[model samples]
Target chain A: MNDGLMIEVENLTKRYSGHAAVSNISFTVRRGEIVGLLGPNGAGKSTTMRILACYLPATSGTVRVAGLDVYEHSEEVRRRIGYMPENNPLHYDMRVREYLKFRARLKGLSRRRSRERVDVVMEQCDLTHVSRRIIGQLSKGYRQRVGLADALVHEPELIILDEPTIGLDPHQIRAVRQLIKSLACDHTVLISTHILPEAEMTCNRMVIMYEGSILAADSPDNLQRFMSGHSQILAEIAAPLEELNECWAQMPEVEQFDVSPAEGAYHRCALTPRDGLDLRPRIYELARQRGWLLRELTRNRHSLEDIYVQVTRPEEEEES
Target chain B: MQAYLTLTRRELSGYFLSMTGYIIIAAALFLMGLSFVVLLEKLQLEPTLMPVTELFYITPFFWLILLLSTPVITMRLFALEKFSGTFETLMTAPVSDREVVLAKFTAALVFYMIMWLPLLGCLLIVRHYTNDPSAFDLGAVGSTFLGILLLGCLFLSLGCCASAMTRSQVTAAMISLVFGATLFLVGVLSSQLPLRPSWQTQVLAALSFFEQMHDFARGVIDTRAVVLYLSATLFFLFLTLRIVESRRWK
Candidate 1:
């Protein structure tokens, strides 16, 4: 059963009163990979993460974590998976250290081990300064850190965080992202977030979900490349439109071209490569040969945001 | 076992950590002290054949404190967790549903017992003043306190059940208060009704909490009353467990 896979979800479909929140989706996370479950609101990312965490039962299909069925071996699975649920609900009455200690014990750590782990997680999450402070009195970022400490106190192998950076400021978000990335050395992380750029930065792979089904699952780079088959080149050259059109026709690498006027008698041209080849060098060389002054020649790359919009736009059309 | 103890300790400390717990204890002790003072005043006016413990247990103030305080004590057992969304974390832990329900029940019962400990101190004050060895009967005091414990077990479980059903502490308290009042009134009113057959009167008397407390104060240990309280407590606790488990299906 040591298949190097930390999570295995098979044809999972979670329905609520005849509505499918997760409709027949499947994906896997390899050990040591920080996989991000990316989707818009109401796209079932939370539902899927909840099932993998064993917090909710799947309506149909099976989910296995660390090679054990989540339903049958729930306690065992729970022992190995640390789940920080959405909004990071915690006891506001208790002090940070006290709450973490209690959670550690509840997660089946021995008293001494719980104490040790509590201190470790406090240091790891940078909550050691506010360890004695009441959670209710702390700020939202500190409270979130306490929640993360609670999850990590048990030393679980797989860490599942649902929107870990949802309400954090930029600095705190960056800090939390670093903490999540640091956890990958000893733990497999599965984080669900709607923040596309955050996933693009932290995840080794992204699982794009839309309307309860996974549209794509790959590295951020691969997703961007696969979603859009061809790359574009933008060129601003001091040349006549007629000559530019003629130059575009001569180059077979340029599939389609659009030209518009720029500043001081300069013309801007947008070119799509037929085989996704680099048209930048070719355009630069062509301008040199034709004695045309090329001011700007740059490749237009697709971001993860663009790919996400492209993947989900078709589903929106079908629904409409 | 460890999870149960940890959860119970948390639940018990939760009461004292908040103002609601301290407020409940203060209000209960104040009512008990007032009831004791009034009872002593009434005793001074005329000597009665009834024992001091019997009179103390039968007061409307005693029932009022019992009925009202049980709901407040158990209302936050489940409702507060649900309100704060911590119930999701609690239920997702590796603990079983039964352990959670039982831990909460045990914590509430312990807090209830602690709230009543002052009543014994009030009785001790009376004994110290009277200076008579036979002035306070140990058997009567023991049985009266036993009756309080048993009734608290049943009523507090009802409160736990109500709390588990909803996320609002006020609604949970109100629901359990209605439950406790209706149960008490049915037994009290049934015993007071006239023109009832002997068999029916006997059954009503058996169900009457006032009658049970009277017997307890007289040192009569009725196994039937004991069974009723214990069984009803378990029944309500079972209902609370089911309510906690219903989240998985819903």
Candidate 2:
């Protein structure tokens, strides 16, 4: 209920018929933060987003937006949050500008204020040129921009976008990512995406969900760090393959190592070190002592995808 | 009030901008004009004879059929939003469910009026061609117009309710038509039963739209009939509002 917390959802659960779509999920989004809800298809991302947007009520839990409970003060919560659904719902028969104007009026803006806000959003979403075009005739990219424009027309405190770049080309995806990044300076945003690279580029923090429960929640860097211990290190050297293998095997800290043929006059070895060990200094000392030519020595950086896989992977694999 | 007015205005304008409105109006006028011609010719009236009185009696039946013909017009009132994903946008807005339902109903009513205007013009033409136009019962004609307005409002409200139940336009239209046809035929179907006269009158009066409409076309503005039409309209409008409000829980 703090002012600094833009959204607070506690023990939220949604049940359809007798089955739970989302069970006991809890998260909070602070003011001016860009958080990503990361999950695959049917991971209850949309259900959670819908609950927070006040479009759907949770079966048993409390959702507070801007310090007001969503169930008791839905109208007030609605006034403070803007939502863009995954499907980009729109009245295709209406012209772009006309639709924005209608949406602005419906959001309770005055005539002059609505007009000004419409113009501002149109420009911000790069929809000014296609303002006169009917929505059905526009391309998918333009339709998405129009949807974003409508969401921002009322100038709410928090904006929730569900798969905003779902059906866009590379260029269009970049454009939307830029627009989302730009929004972070002025408004708090909660974006949901199954695309790991997209989340890495657009969001400041991420919550990974699996089977209707959050598996992990942290910043991108922190998530990578959490998975880095299990990452493999690759070293390419210009020394006798047998000597490199022997040196790596003798190092008790080296848990496992394998040497294979590299491009030319070089041998590539992948090494897994013990947990919490830094193999770079050890490898450097070994290469210097053997007067070996070190062509490539790199610690493979773990990506969001690797972190996601690690967090959601089964306990059997984790033990291995 | 401003939100209501703005939504209503947008809805009203949407009707004229689409081909559905034009097609419905054109078909209604064609049927009404044909019925008017047949009635006048069968009565063996002269070419110059005024048939305004006859027009009023026949127009309601044609309007009734026309009401069923384009039930889809209002069926898409909320169904299209749900189908096309616009309902999410509307629900997230500051406008209440009452405003959305009322705006859609008012838009359908205004379109119905535009459709009826051409028939009114035909009446004026008949008046112009007659030598004794004063003999025409203006009171009956006025009452019938009022009756059609009320009936149109009722049908629109019913269509809104059906639309709110589903996101498919075709399914919404079918539901409304089935319900409307049943309401219209109730009076005729009930008379075949061996019921007492008092009971028959009460049941038929309660069930029949045409019965109430006939009373209006006879130059008698029965307050009971007026109450029936208004009650039906308000009841369906309220039901539509409730259906829309329930979407938040889903």
Candidate 3:
């Protein structure tokens, strides 16, 4: 067990009957690291998070949190971790402040300390104004904030959030993303989401899972860089397709070229650059020299979405 | 201990804050009051007659039916958390399964006491009307109250166990009601068996909640009845705790 790591999951597996929901998987989250568990639905992201939070036990292997085995020290692990499920389950009858204070006390805080913690989390989650209102009466956004506040009230070192922004509007999504980013300074966070944009914006590192197995684990930038070599450039020109293809093929930087008809008199072509070469400046110079109109020229940057597809693609496509 | 107290306090506060608690109390009181009026008229008894004692006699019947509604009050105790996603928050806290179950059970018991208060008031009124209220069967009344308390505790535990089995409140209530009714009816049906008087008494006594209540109604304070009620209460509570603990594995 690594003392520096806040969470350590080794060969963790959850099987329902004979079928595995989460196959043998392993990972570690060190203190102050914001890691994303990115996967599509049924990809076992939520199942893995639940095991780490001690809400559910793994069928096989071990999970340790705060240097304690989760199975042997569940109460200790629970005290050291805060978890927010995908549905944000809460008792709607209790007031927001009351609920948070109740949760703080359940985490074994002294009454005075619980109150103080509740106030701090209320402010952090922006739930102070509606602290006296019943949770059921609050809007979806405020209810979500209340859920986050309850999770933070005990000041756990680790926070596991499952699909935190599933139903939120754009503004609410941005707010939650910002809050998650701010939490990374003080707490280790493991957030699960199928939404690529949410993971890209809030997580510093991510693990991509497909069919209950981890396909890759690295920083977002590094994962994108993994798909960098097989790049394609798109260019639109208001010239004859035959002429554009001939010129694109002549350039030494352009390793391969394909031209297709565009709307009206324009033509579209894909230019594959040779090793360690950028063809944009060369293409611009060629357009200037030949008086050929260059309508558009842009390099295709690999996004998290592209990498998700690449990592999860079939074995045949993955090898190719 | 502190976590148990905190959770119990929250549950008790929830009962007072919501209409479910008030509604159950009001309904029980209204039925008790209506029955007192009809029973008084039929017996042609004075207002000072031991109306409260008669009212206590009918409590088990009312409780058997009213306790069915108690599940609606407590069905959301743990099930609501599971349904609304708040269970994830509770399960991750440092509290033990025993603490959580006991807290919720105690809260429901307290609410049951509050519901019984109005009937206690009716007893006080009976005391005021009688010339020799001290002659009244205070022993019987005390025993009856004990029976009621034990029965309430038993039902609450049963409800909690039923609620823990599912996330749906309606399903919890239905299952609890079915089980409670079966227990109540078994007692009634066993009494009609054409067997030796001693054998009949033994079997009917085992199944009969009313038989258990008879000792209390006579102010006898049967230790055996007390033990039976308590054991039943503990049995259901233990089952509820086990159900909650197993959830972590699933």
Candidate 4:
């Protein structure tokens, strides 16, 4: 039976001779969801992706792709999953069109279908311009697209990319990110990257892995909120510390406040809201009522980096 | 089956599209031409009972060409994929490990056979110029080609096994070179050494690739040699398949 789930991994542990690469990790991805396996280097992201793509077998536990057990139905799972491995490895000697067509045919497409998909994927990946050029002669960005085109040529149900944007310039990264975002309409994407901005921008949900185990799994917004109970607000005003303390005490939205002296006459006041409330307007109105010189009034929301760092800090500290 | 054919075509085109394949063919042509001229001179200087095919197949240059070219042809089979990081993409395709190994072996063996095609051309050129109908027997030449094909199968499979074991093409070539040289050396040493036991002599004689080639050159179809080479080829291919599958464990 084809369930709504595209991938189902439970208690998956991949152990090398000396150590485990992925240890008892469990996660799932629904169809048509862009899920990011976010982790740093040596975090077993590639190892997990490899296992899911049927390139590597797990030492223990089970992985199912499209309701088929990966170990037992590897050929079927591989036919359904298009995997662009780390570094986007490709045949350097083959031209783009030739390579994509070869990959399409290898993935079980008919001859005419392979040709049609090669053209379609080449256009989708913006590789139409360099379709005749040798892959070894192409730039890194074009090579990355060619790898992407190869992955997409067969029109697989699931696309797994490991560090798809790595080693690309900002422009290329943005383009690749947009391309990945567009793929979510038709296919389920399970991309792994250490770049927080990439996950924040492209992925609908993220599973943060650290030291071979999943640390957290949620949407970016929920992760930020769950990591810290409430968001903080920063307000710098050229007013006395006692006045700021009295002003903060007056507003119940300001659950906690700390005032530190700045250069000249400005005082930096950090306030944590009691709830997930926008305290910036209230702080601005307070400054106007008190006739205080407001230099800065802004909500200090946690970026994905901050949440990732906070989530991964305990284990990093334990290792140290 | 389609995936296997596609992979085989890709590998065969890889050899031809690059300069390595042409260089190999050119070197084989030169070596074969030189050996032919040397054989002609030796024949002109003295008469012998051996047929032209027997003399041509028994030349040291023939064995040297086979020994050297098979490694170069097969070294890039799996090692280059691993080196370029395409092994993941290749293995992740729907094809099984057996197909992957067999495709590479078949491609290399085909290329090896193509590399020796110049010898037939040399034979034809000699036959045309001399206008001698009995210069080289067609049956002997056919058996000689069959013997070469069998040996090519064994050598290419051994080289494929070596290539599957390592990522470095140079290391793969060296390993297969060692394997091929050891096989040849055992044959040579067995013939040279005076073994007292009759069974030992019979076994070594059966194992000797030189003896096998000599018999085939004389149009003698020895089923023992055919079975031995075929079995060894299968054994090496089985080893290569295991090596390719070992990546799952690694």
Scanning candidate 1 chain B in windows of ten residues, the lowest lDDT window is B126-135
Steric overlap count per candidate: 0, 0, 5, 0
TM-score of each: 0.95, 0.91, 0.87, 0.94
Cα shift from native, residue A306, model 3 (Å): 1.1
Residue A179 in model 4: lDDT: 97
Candidate 4, true inter-chain contacts retained: 0.85
Worst 10 residues of 1 chain A by lDDT: A222-231
Question: Which is superior by lDDT, 2 or 4?
Answer: 4
| Global Cα lDDT for candidate 2 | 0.83
DockQ, all models: 0.63, 0.61, 0.59, 0.70
Alpha-carbon deviation at A10 in model 3, angstroms: 2.0
- Model 4, stretches more than 4 Å misplaced? A228-230, A236-244, A259-268, A281-296, A314-320, B193-197
Best by DockQ: 4
State the lDDT of candidate 1 residue by residue for A1-320, as single tens digits.
65999999999999988999999999999999999999989999999988887778899898999899998897888889888899999999999989999999998899999989988989999999998999999999999898888878888889999999988999999999999999998899999999999999999999999989999999988887774556788999999999998889888777899999998979999999886677788788888998999888888888788888877786557588
Candidate 3 chain B has its poorest 10 consecutive residues by lDDT at: B42-51
lDDT of 4 by residue, A149-243 (tens): 88888889999999999999999999999999999999999999999989999999999999999999998888877755567888889998898
lDDT of 3 by residue, A104-140 (tens): 8888999899989988988988888999998989989
After aligning candidate 3 to the native by TM-score, how far in Å is the CA of A66 from where it should be?
Answer: 2.3
For all candidates in order, the CA lDDT equals 0.89, 0.83, 0.81, 0.89
- In candidate 2, how many Å is residue A222 off? 0.6
- Cα lDDT tens digits, model 2, A49-92, are 98887778899988888889887888788888889998898888
* Clash pairs, model 1 backbone: none
